[model samples]
Target: MRQEPEGYAWSRFGQPEYTNWLDESMSWKETCYIGDWSFLWQHRFTGPDALKLISDFTVNNFEVFDLYQSKHAVHTNKDGKVIHEGVLTRFGDEDFMVHGRGGFWLAYNLEKGNYDASVTNEDWFMYQVSGPNALALLQKLSGSQDLADARYMRAVTITVAGHEIFALRQGMAGEIGFELQGPSSIGAEIYQAVLEAGRDFGIRKMGGRIAMINHLEASFPTIATDYIPAIFDEDMSGYREYFLSSMPPFAKPAYINGSYDGKDISEYYRSPIELGWAKVVTTKRNDYLGAEALAAEKQSPKRVLRTLEWNGDDVLEVQRSLFEPGEHFAYMEMPRDQRGYMWADRVEVDGELVGVATSRGYSYYFRKMLSLATINVDHADVGTEVEVLWGAPGQRQKAIRAVVCPAPYKEDRSRGQLG
Candidate 1:
């Protein structure tokens, strides 16, 4: 008899959920939240060669990276596959900060290549205050009722809880939000102040489970969740070993989920266009690594990112199996993917494999099961019929019917909110 294999899992970045998962998820839609983001890495670069070196690797048009402004930076391999991506901010002519794994990619390149720049990882703490009431909370904490004036992706330094914080008018939930970044030493002070001040506005604390709901609702593709880190392959083995050596045991990338019938892991790598970041790639006369290849690939992308709406009845049927059946499918975790494995599920059209779905989750705001999928362009049209191969392979897998829908399943309120 085969005991169900110990299910895969991941640790939430924070202490734990303050509010329950369901309420915390609904907070983004009804009120607001303060999400602990210190788990993400921030890499800072300074010196004359910093901008040039970054430009050499980034797919974005850095011609417009002015002080106090930030751009979505994406780095791809020589083959045009995304190596890493995150927000790149310019604080001065030659001083910059990039947050997320993209920082690791930059760090790796800095060590190998000859560049006259100094790179250091900063342990700065980051907190996201988001939703309709987010600005209200910021105003209350900073006493800067005028904080609402900060434009999108622009950074403004202000004192909050008596600590200087660089507040960027950005958000993950696609709502009116601010990313408060500052010294790690005062992270606790700032976080506590905001929580107390935001009580009136109904601010909830976000946990790992509910924090990423908007990624699916707003249609943001994520690394590790959507595709494996590009650093794990043979071509990147040297860098991969070096990267893993410095990390803790729990941080390794060792899980593969879903029923992707691919023999090679590289079969899952995605290009910028396929990931819905085509606009970020700009070569226009300036050649970067993979510039020519990406320019060519964009002309005819194999697939495009989209949202798949699962059939409610079929989904319910899968859940119903849990009670009576000898072999029941895994239960759908709320707000985000559970069972690890990047939550990728194979997509098919008339039983012919077409693409793979990633970032599967349920959005209570929309009251639907949603997943970000990189589908074959041939069948990428809205309203197209397809099926999601749910559950682990050879483990009571079920085919749930689905429909092609818009990538951002909801309106992105983060675009141009004034306050």
Candidate 2:
């Protein structure tokens, strides 16, 4: 028997559930919720080449990148596969802070390149307050109407709990949201303030158990969850060595499971185009790394991201199999996918593999089981019916029926429409 892979490894914030998973999961949609993401890695790049350093490898155009603006930066390998991605906020003409694994990639290249840029590992607190009433809660805490005029993807200085911090309007829940970032020492203080002020607004503390549910419903394909980083390939062996030796153990050795096993590791990788991030990639500049490959891919992309609604009856039948004797199917974890590993399933049409399904979870708000899938462009259409292969290979696999739906199964209210 194969050893099952573990879920994501991160320090827990308070308890696994402040209330309950079900109620907490629904808070983002019905009311509001705050989740701590301070565990994410951050790096500050400074000097004349800061923007140039990022622009050289990332797909985003920086010709008109405004001050105090944040871009969902994406870095791809020579083959046009995504290596790392995250939000990068510009603080000054030559100063920037990027969150997530993207920083690691940037830092590595900075050391090897001849650029005048330098990077420092930063420590900070990141908390995302999102939902319909998210902005109202922030306004109450800051006691200012300035946030009401804050543009999407722009960072503004706000005083909260007597401490000033940068609030970037970046929503990850398909609703209006803000990410408050500041010194690590004051993270706890501001968190308590937000919690206290949010009581009347029905705010809930989001736990790790159901944290990624918002990402699923909003069509955000995460790094380790949706696709593995592109650094593991043999060509990137040097960087891989540096990554393993320099970073913490939990960040290394990403494992994959489920039925969509591929022949080569590259098969598990994804490009910006395939991941529905084409708008951010610019073909105007041909000098960046992998620009040629990405341009060619842009001309003829193969896969596209989408949502899959698993048949409720079929999902229930898998659960029902536990009591009735025969070979029991793999247990379907409720509300979200297993945290530690990439739980990718095989998506097929009439027995022919067409796509890979991931981030499988149940949404209480919708009362349906949904998963984000990268399907073949030919079969990637709303209302198209497909099948999701559940359980590991040779382990009572069941082909559960599913339907292709909008990439963001929920209406996207993240940008330009704040109330």
Candidate 3:
């Protein structure tokens, strides 16, 4: 059997067993599931200017963030194109841990030698405890009923299974979830303790495939797939070398396969508007890395990321109708279209090309097909009729009708209640 990650358990039993367990536990019953997110890059930034550096680099205003409060941050290029996105948790006045995608971008910033910031990758383990009964399970494990008092995004130092750990009430499952992060040495103990506590709650371990599909329901965008890194010209050469050398072997094969959209890397760059990040970009703040360009783009916003629900029957019929079968439907990547490298500003409307679709997925829970696309502001209004090219040119090409709608088609279910 292949060895799993340091903090993960092998789910080689079978796909159906694992998938069914996750689906049932996460849906109807109040159950908990543990996920190993240790592969995610964790950085510790400490220095008086650390906060300032983060504010200058990301679209979210970090000045108002209080200690122990976590917020989402997005780093954009000078052209307002999205480079990296993650969650920033403030532990102290000058200390915070940035979690999620974009380790390469963080390393590039350190190599630039521009600020007084010091970054240290933490040798940590992340465990996501999610489900309707997560809080009860955690309380039972830690022997502390105060687990419910820990508000969302709030971090508290707690002891679990006789091991000290930091528990953050954050997750991508769109359910009541908490991330338990601590040293690797004690990871197994923590996992076992949680499992023991969750025994009566029907807890199960989830794989990457289960998590990936659930993230789509949460409308989470991953780096390297949903967007590309924004390497400055001066840092490109060094960045490329680092990415090639430092990436895990499992990721290397995919990187070599390039053209995630089956087109080109240039088609992978996207702006904040195209990734459903409009609320995070604040132009009123002082000059930032992408202030000027983003400001101009905001005034005359070309495209906005909106969600679309595919007609289920129509999509299924098309697939079943194929006799000899044809190329499977390609999910949206970057630029939304393959005619050429389409930036946020160049998208048009009417006789013009309005926008580009970025990420698309089928929601099993909602029983609907959904996609996130960036379109011209004129056509961004909800309910606006739009046409999306179904297939590539010179193939079975056709325009599919779609309606403009708010992103996160399942918003209510996502933010309903904390377990």
lDDT of each: 0.81, 0.87, 0.63
Which predicted model would earn the best TM-score? 2
| lDDT per residue as tens, model 3, 189-280 | 88888878877888887754345445556666555445556653453567667766776543331131111223444455667766767777
Query: Model 1, 1-419: lDDT tens per residue?
Result: 11232544334447346678778888878899988877777899999999878888889987677798988899888888888888899999889999887887777888888999989989988888899898877887788855778889998887887777899888688788889999899999999998998999999988777666768888888776787666756888877877778655445553666766667777767788889999998958456777888998788788899999999999988888888749888777666654445667889998899889988888887889888899999989999999999877778888999999998887888867474
Best candidate, lDDT: 2
Model 3 scores a TM of 0.79
Q: Tell me each candidate's TM-score.
A: 0.94, 0.97, 0.79
Clashes of 2: 3
Candidate 2 per-residue lDDT, tens place, 274-367, comes to: 8889899899998788899999989888889999999999999899999899799988877765546778899999999999998998888889
Q: Assess the local accuracy of residue 40 in candidate 3 as a C-alpha lDDT between 0 and 100.
A: 67
Which regions of candidate 3 deviate over 4 angstroms?
1-17, 21-31, 101-103, 232-235, 249-264, 322-352, 397-401, 413-419
Better of 1 and 2 by TM-score: 2
Clash statistics: count for each candidate = 0, 3, 3
Q: What is the lDDT of residue 107 in candidate 2?
A: 89
Could you list the CA RMSD of all candidates, in the order they appear? 2.5, 1.6, 6.4
Clashes of 1: 0
Models sorted by lDDT, best on top? 2, 1, 3
